[model samples]
Target chain A: MRTSKKYIVTGLFLILLIILLSCELMLGSVYIPAQNVFSVLTNNEHQNEVWNTIILQSRLPRALGAIIAGASLSVSGLLMQVLFRNPLASPYILGISSGAGLGVALITLGSVGIGFTFVPNGLSLVASAMLGALLVFSIVFFISLKVKDVMTLLIAGVLIGSIANAVVNIIQLHASALAVKTFVLWTLASLDQLEMTDIKLLYIICPLTLIGSFLLSKQLNALLMGEKYARSVGVNILLSRILIILFSGILAASITAFCGPIGFIGIMVPHIVRIIFRTNHHKLLILFSVLIGSCTLLAADLMAHYFITSVSLPINAITALIGIPVILWLLLGKKDISKTI
Target chain B: MHTILEIKNIDVSYKQQKVLENGSLTLKESTLTALLGRNGSGKSTLLNTISGFLKPTKGEILVSGVNIYKSNPATRARLISYLESTPLSPQNISVKELVAFGRYPYLDLFTSLSESDLTIIHSALFQCGLSQFSDRFFNELSDGEKQKVFIARAIAQNTPLIILDEPTSHLDFIARREIINLLKTLCLKENKTIFFSSHEPELCVELADRFVVTANHTFSEVNKTEVLKTLINS
Candidate 1:
């Protein structure tokens, strides 16, 4: 009975997400009728092949891309914040995303001028990105075992991230202008590159990871209290720590592989959910987070789409632009974020 | 009286600096215990060791004759509930939900509250006189009320033994008295073994049924008046 309100709130968020999805389909560079968008989505054959390709191949995947990317970034942000016990922690800022970016960089830059003409498709980049993220994740994961301090891991992640960034910069310096330009564009972060195949892959990884987070909801709740408090209550602190790092790493790495390092969704979305839901149940919070995160990136995608019809802006820049202010307001708005979680 | 807790010759050290050595003590069931010592007397360390957070350099702790360190966290949690001094009050959690975390040991990750689990949570809240405050945010409660919430969480754990490093360290005089009386009530009414560490030996001597003093690397029993005199002179 008490949970009825969360159901209503989540239901509303889902509705908002659907409405935004419809808007995304209708409001791209070439506007199609709301009716045609529906017919195409329902898998009905339309008369015009070009309009069908634009709808089925381009707009649909891009919109799904925004939804999955938003959800993944926000959920991982929630993980990082709880893991570090700091409200400011995010996958992008923590260098988790940069670790993925490094993976992309090694592949994107290293093969330059070698006459290796491999198609740099979404699947390949995603694989490279996942590899890079897992590499840094393992380092942080093992260190978490010895350190047992989230603050230390936070510092280590940032340091490892910086080292990775420095290395990427060196690679860029030696790389050809074309290679460097492509790497820079990837860092800008966009949803345009995602295809239906990439979206299908994410449909598996993202949902599974979200479910994994839901299963560990109790441990995350324990963690929000503090390590000693959690352990005293029978939570396996070390196991929980390792699992959290891996889960967040996988979530971040998957998104970075697909869409580059989309900034601030993780930090910004969880805070918004906290402010709205105002409850501490991670299961419920995770649900609210995924919904709100889905809506957020859709809105961000729309904003990027409409910012200038001539050329779209990077989704990463838009999220940071929106995210920084929300953080500022949360800190200044008497939100009581200074409490342990 | 049955021995509910046995701390056997524990040698606890922090970074090679031994704080307690060769300390052996047994506490009986249904008694209020106060661990008294001067500053840096290893009272917290001993409590943490007993709670299974710290492994002693050489000794084992037994809860109801079972070696706690050899047991799993969930099993140990069912046997003993522990509270740290100055516990962090996580924001955005209601007092009721916070107390429900106590039932964690009995339930799995996917299990929702059964009828009896809800009953126990309500009882823990009722025992602490927090029925009206159950829905309030834990961080918004007053200092004394917050401390009672912590105790209520431990109570809801339904463990035989509850250990606290310092429950009243941050309370005012009236709050301190209220907490002491509450602990006394828990021992009497609920028949729970409540062992707590405190620097306030004078207040503790008046309240506790048993006094265990730690000084000069040893633990020895003392009477109420003797505890007061020893703490004052030392």
Candidate 2:
């Protein structure tokens, strides 16, 4: 009976995902008919070359971007919450995005655009962003080892993020006007402008990291049991901590590297999954989180693409617009927020 | 072997402040022992040191003749299971799932429960009278049931030695008696060595086969907790 219910929910989610995907394809700036979307998807000989270009080049990547980036961010959020044992914990609060943003700022700010080198410019961003994120993560990870207090470690992470943001602000000031515009535009592009190559990298990195997180589910659950309690049950605290941090870092960094630092999806999607599923089994949470995340971003992208014909709403704006109210309601509700954190 | 756990003149300190100084004891097999101490008397420190969670400044603790501090976490876990006196109850976990986590030390980084693991978990729940409550959320359970779940988790761990700090401290007398009864049953049936700390000396005298007490930074093995009570007042 339980299995049947799960199947029904999964089926419903799958249908929603497909409809949103189709809508995403049909509702871009240059609207294509729903039938054209079907032919284009099936690779039938559609004579409309413009429809073909928009679907294959722009809309296709954006839709795929929504699926992967959304799933990655959401899973990252769940992992962060499990790791920190804090309901409010997410990649945004931990500032992995800020650190990656700082890296992007450094590269885009000046003449040494390594993208001009043998490595693809997009690939360069990935490396720099990953590097910056790993650096900050290492700092936080070390602080976690040294400082036993959770509040202290969280405060230290916030302080590190502030420092990174400070550097980014200085870079914004020093860079040329074009550099500033590039950075600004990059920040605006969440799950858009993802080159096929970057998408391929994401296919490899995201699933690998996500799988790593799933494999660590048992350890993650142990962590929720309280560190001391977890250890008594034979959890390798150090190993689990390192793996959680690494997985979260890689997931968040890749998303930021490819699609500018998108906000709130990472924080929002997991809460939605938990609310919907009413369970915290990591395996189930991870699976549902992925599906719901994909559907949400696809829906959000559809809205962003079709919200205003003249101007496209950025994905970040759409997510925040959706996220803030949910957050406020959660706060206003009698959820005993302290117990969760 | 008569001795299941041996602590050899161990010293524990935090921030260079000594908590337990020159503590030594031998825990016999299949016996229920209670560690009695005042607040800041280092009952927790001593238990932690024995469990290999805390590194002592000096000396060794051996379980089944193997130096626990020298042993790896996995090796130590195989020999002994531990429980903290006060733990933040985790949410969204079922009693069964929480008990299944006891198999953690045996499984890989990404653990998969085997048939044997499942059987062990069931037996643990059965022993704790929690088989019916397997699907119940941990936080929703009563305090007494929650403590049993902790013990059941440790029981499923299947170690010869179990050390708990203050398992019955906050519980009512009935709950306290229940926990002691449960521990006594575990000792008799499983032939396990159970060492638990408690503030209530009278309760310890009623249930424990042996008593270890802490006073003025020293841990001394006492034949009876009442004798130690008299010594403390003196």
Task: Write the residue-wise lDDT of candidate 1 on B87-168 in tens digits.
Answer: 7778889998999989888889789789999999999999999999998888889989999999999999998899988889
DockQ of each: 0.75, 0.54
Predictions in order: chain A TM-score: 0.92, 0.88
Over the stretch A129-175, how does candidate 2's per-residue lDDT look in tens digits?
A: 77777777778778877776556777888899899999898767766
After superposition, the stretches of candidate 2 with alpha carbons farther than 4 Å from their true spots are A1-4, A31-35, A107-151, A174-182, A330-334, B225-231
Candidate 2 global TM-score: 0.91
Among all candidates shown, the one with the greatest TM-score = 1
Interface RMSD of 2: 1.9
Model 1 C-alpha lDDT per residue in residues A168-208, reported as the tens digit of each score: 88777767777777788889889988888889999999899
lDDT of 2 at A111: 44
Superposing every Cα of model 2 onto the true structure, what RMSD results? 3.2
Measured over all alpha carbons after superposition, the RMSD of each candidate to the real structure, in angstroms, is 2.0, 3.2
**Can you give the TM-score per candidate against the true fold?**
0.95, 0.91
| Candidate 1 chain B, poorest ten consecutive residues by summed lDDT | B225-234
Per-residue lDDT value at B167 in model 1: 89
Model 2 chain B lDDT-worst window of ten: B225-234
Pairs of residues at least 3 apart in sequence or in different chains that clash in candidate 1: none
